[model samples]
Target: MKFGKIIAAGVLAASLAMPAASFAADKPVVGLVMKSLANEFFKNMLEGAKAHEAKRGDYKLKAVGMQSETDIETQINAVESFITEKVNAIVIAPADSRALVPPLKRAMEAGITVVNFDVALDEKAKKEAGVELAFVGPDNRAGAKMAGEALAKKLGEGGKVVIIEGNPGADNAAQRKLGFEDAIKDGKLKLLDSRTAHWETEEANSVFANMLTAHPDIQGVMAANDSMAVGVVKAIEAAGKTGKIEVIGFDNIPAVQPLLKEKKMLATVDQFGQQMAANAIDKALGVLAVGAPLKGWVKTDIKLVTSDDVK
Candidate 1:
């Protein structure tokens, strides 16, 4: 009887231990690949994704973030690693639109559901790779245009302005640049020089300072993200242009709040970064369950924030 009891206890212990492993296996593993966690926007995204993983309790999430904003290699390696692990799904906010398509296509071919968010992959690249991943993010162009238009309105027609762009190859960067150009055209603003700071604040500061030096008559500045906007604002302060140059940016991160409130930054676009990854994860899981890929763009909310909104 004692021997029997020992066997039963051993079985119970094994069963208890097995449950965790079994449960984890049964749940879908959704791999999340995000851009630089160093940036406030991506940092918020990571936090929100963690909150979502805890709340959902249905799926296991493996998230990987880049070392820097321009780190496409990390993202590529991350996708390859996720593929080797054979995760059920991959929800990626790709660093480079074209470069990520190939690995993502391989993931799809391996029967993994892939959802692209934050930035849409290039159409030509997708077609070439035969990848039809759905983009689950905001209308970056429209959002950027809204911010640009606010700057345009503030500066009025014939306002000399320079653009401090994001990463060169990033899709969102390209779209935002185009949007800013659209606003410049519509607003009849003078285009001085548009250069990229690769989404770094310090770089933006340096670049804007140089541009300011080149074009001292610059009336307005449009930054692709709020981080860069903060940099531009500092450059303005250092150059003694503080209240003289009107600035606008994207991503309504907390750091930019004071800038907006103080009227240092004319406006910014809130694309709801915190919830973006979660929303994309939801779609990825839905695709996994339904066995149907998400089609086209799954547009999310984007709003323009000005001093009034902050106030």
Candidate 2:
């Protein structure tokens, strides 16, 4: 009887320790790739991802990004590194939507689950590449539509509004522009001109400066991102018409908050990038933990932030 008791205790101890070993071995690993670390929006996303990693003991995360938004090659290389490291999942805010497809497809084919956030993957390309990827991000078109509708409300129809866009290849930029177009189309807002600034503040400043010269009577400005929007405000100021025109921007970056608070800019769309990152991490981990299949798209919240929304 004593011998039987000893055997039972040994079996109980082995059973208890098995879970610890299993958990340690079974922890999911994810790689987070962003456009560029220089932008506050991407930095905020990284912070949210890291904070989530710290709180969740069941996963490990590593983050890497390009130094500039146009560095598609660097982004591709980063994905390759993650692939070599054999991470179970990859969550990326791609630098360029179409360019990242090949590398992302390679990862997916290598048995890694890939989740895209902040921008969308080209679905046609994904099909062509013969690999699948899951997407998580704000509805860029809807968010921009919100900003456009708010600007329309302020302008009250027939207001001449110009659009400054980001990199032409950026999926989010295109979607935001589409949203702006959709909103202004119904409102019959006169489009003075639209130009691409490649998500550069200086380029946007120069572009809007020229727009002001060509269309001095413009009543409003629509920007695909906050950086360009901030640049538009600078141009308006340079033209000595700062507070006269309604400027609406997307991505409620902190730098634009002052302009909003002072009522120089009408409103911005808060894409909630941090929340997007958190949700991406959660979904990526789910893929590795239980083979939870993330489907076509997982969109987060978006809000129209005005001067009143700032405080």
Candidate 3:
């Protein structure tokens, strides 16, 4: 009778273990890999993702990324690690759009869903690899157009201006430059000089300093992002021409708030980093929980923040 009871107990334990195994299988795991957490933008993105994960318990979110924006190899390793862990889905903001294709393709081959945000993947690679389930981020062109129009209005009918571009091959930087040129197409404002600052404040400051010497009559400056804008503003101040030059930037970060308050920054375009993160997580959950179709794009709206509109 004791031996019979032992056998029955073993059967009951096995039965209980089966349901727990099934429950574990039911919970979906998602991996989010960003460019890096060094920047406030990516940090906000992580927070937004976490907030969404908290609301939806069925999905498990694993967040990891490079320590610095320039560490592409580290990002690749992180993605590989996610693949080894067998995540159901992967969300990434790639550092180099082209270079990341191979690893991303490998993830897809391993049956992991991949989503691209912030930066985009190369069109050819994206099509050929059949990776990248979706892209969610701002309408960069529209954002740039709004920023350009704001700068143009500040510069009046005619003025000389300099553009501080981010990275040379960065799609967002190129789009912003194109939008700015399109906005000022009436020949009212001439682009005196344009240089790539690589999104570095020091580089932007140095570029602007050199440009000032070459074109002493520059009336306005438009930077691709706020970090570069801060550098441009510093250059203007160093040259003793802060209020004299109209400066505008993209990404209305908290650091730019005081500058706007003091009327030193004319305006900035808000990319809504937090919204991007929230949306990414929402889509990721939908795919994991409901087996929803993952092939689509979501565009977040941008807002123009000026001194007058700060409140």
Top-lDDT candidate index: 1
Better of 1 and 3 by TM-score: 1
Tens-place lDDT per residue, model 2, 21-130, is: 33358776778888877777778778877887787666888889878778888889989999899777777877687888888877766767777777787778768877
Question: Which candidate tops TM-score?
Answer: 1
Q: List pairs with backbone clashes in candidate 2.
A: none
For all candidates, the clash counts are 0, 0, 0
lDDT per residue as tens, model 1, 90-138: 8888889889888887877776777777777888997797544455567
lDDT of 2: 0.77
| Model 2 ranges with Cα > 4 A deviation | 1-26
- Return whichever of 2 and 3 wins on TM-score: 2
Please give the CA lDDT of all the candidate structures: 0.81, 0.77, 0.71
By lDDT: ranked, best first: 1, 2, 3
Candidate 3 lDDT by residue in tens digits, 1-311: 11110000000001011123433577767778876575666677788778767866777888886765567788689789998997776777777766777887787677566666676666677677664345556666677678778888878777788889876545577777887777667547888888988766778899999999999999988888888899899999999998999888887877788899998999998876655645555555444444444445555567889998776
**What C-alpha root-mean-square deviation, in Å, does candidate 3 show against the real structure?**
11.4
